[model samples]
Target: MTKRSTPSSPQSRGNAPRKSGGGWPIPTPGDVLCYAYLWAREAAQGQEEGLKDRPVVVVLAATDTGNGVRLTVAPITHSAPDGAEGAVEVPLAVKRDLGLDRERSWIVVSEVNGFLWPGPDVRPLADGSPFYGAIPDWLFLRMREGIGVHAGRGRVRVTKRTE
Candidate 1:
């Protein structure tokens, strides 16, 4: 009979002592997610007006019971400045337009139409929540909401059904 080899240990598998890449390792998935979220939130607050012609990353939460998925602010790389209010929770009216009625759903923003709306109604995700809700400001952006296209990264793509 042939002999079987033993499986590798966590340490041997390079996963035992998970570090934040302080030096010996690299940032973890959790770290990236948190960083991306903060960056999006900050971007939303910097502008006095709504987002237009700006590319944003859409963040989708893995869990359904919690805050659920989120759409990141444009650029997907800008970090939120300290002392700045966290991303404004999405406004309520925006959610209704986007057809988000449940907590478990993907978030998305697109440019297939080639323009972002001037500004739309906004509402908070929840009471006292700092996260800003969706506000489609570009006309093209509005049309792209349900249009099919490969999302850049960190953004969610939802397709709207045509009757």
Candidate 2:
């Protein structure tokens, strides 16, 4: 998790963002970005683009050489989880603050995707912000715990997004 300095550093990563230099919004943990997330199953089926664009949480982000950032993001979905996916419910209050819809959503920590920042699938808000907003610290920690638990059990499926 080597962090790099930026003008608009990420609160979660401590060294992320360069909003003024603008291109890709600096990635930070807990920041929810709208992206076309390619699932492992889809990748295995030879699919490249995500079936649909969805909100994904930046669970892990590390600066790569030359301004590029590598990220591991978990999908947020309205589907009710069965508990095996290490899904954590987004507190209604938190959702409201982020301006998300009233529909219940869960951060699916058991599954994640890896990609470079500003990848083709990553899309910004209409206002050009990198993310909608960040989830609370407590909630992030819970998601982290789920990631750890699933990783320990070898259940976390990481689908790599390639050019």
Candidate 3:
């Protein structure tokens, strides 16, 4: 996956106060992040394809590691829900608040992943100026609720949520 310039030194990335002795941006719950995910393809020899760069919402608060922060994120997809089992629809207002260009998108709660901040596979959104922002608190709470319900079904593994 291609890498963008590293997120502007932590202080300018978000409104959240910088961590003491800051190293990486401390992503808060509801923050939207850009990431490149590798999706597996149904092919011989377990071939896979990259999902390329996309926006993902930070569902869990970040943990500051001295080296970098780790975050749990849910990918935002433009696909129709069609009653998909674990898809959580992102409301228009929430999308607007997050500055997402797509009019309609779904947070694939079942596909959450842990990412290291400012890493090659993930970084803050910066096309010209920093566009990194957070979704509304209410929307984030609803998504977390959906994730909990989905998790309780025992379909998504605990390791996927924790690791």
Top of the candidates by lDDT: 2
Clashing pairs in 3: none
TM-score of 2: 0.83
Full candidate order by lDDT, most accurate first: 2, 3, 1
- What digit string (tens of lDDT, one per residue) describes model 3 on residues 75-159? 7888876566677788786666556665778877665766455555663445532235666666677778878877888654322
Winner on TM-score between 1 and 3 is: 3
lDDT of 2 by residue, 1-163 (tens): 3222322223433444353234545666877888999988898999989998888889888876865678899998899998655699998887786668999999988889998887888876676655767777778888999999999999999998885
Error of 1 at 52 (Å): 22
Residue 159 lDDT in model 2?
A: 95
Runs off by more than 4 Å, candidate 2: 1-22, 65-67
Looking at model 3, which ten-residue stretch has the lowest summed lDDT?
Answer: 1-10
Among all windows of ten consecutive residues in candidate 2, which has the lowest summed lDDT? 1-10
After superposition, which runs of candidate 1 have C-alpha atoms over 4 Å from their true positions? Answer: 1-13, 16-20, 27-32, 39-44, 47-103, 107-163
Q: TM-score rank, highest first?
A: 2, 3, 1
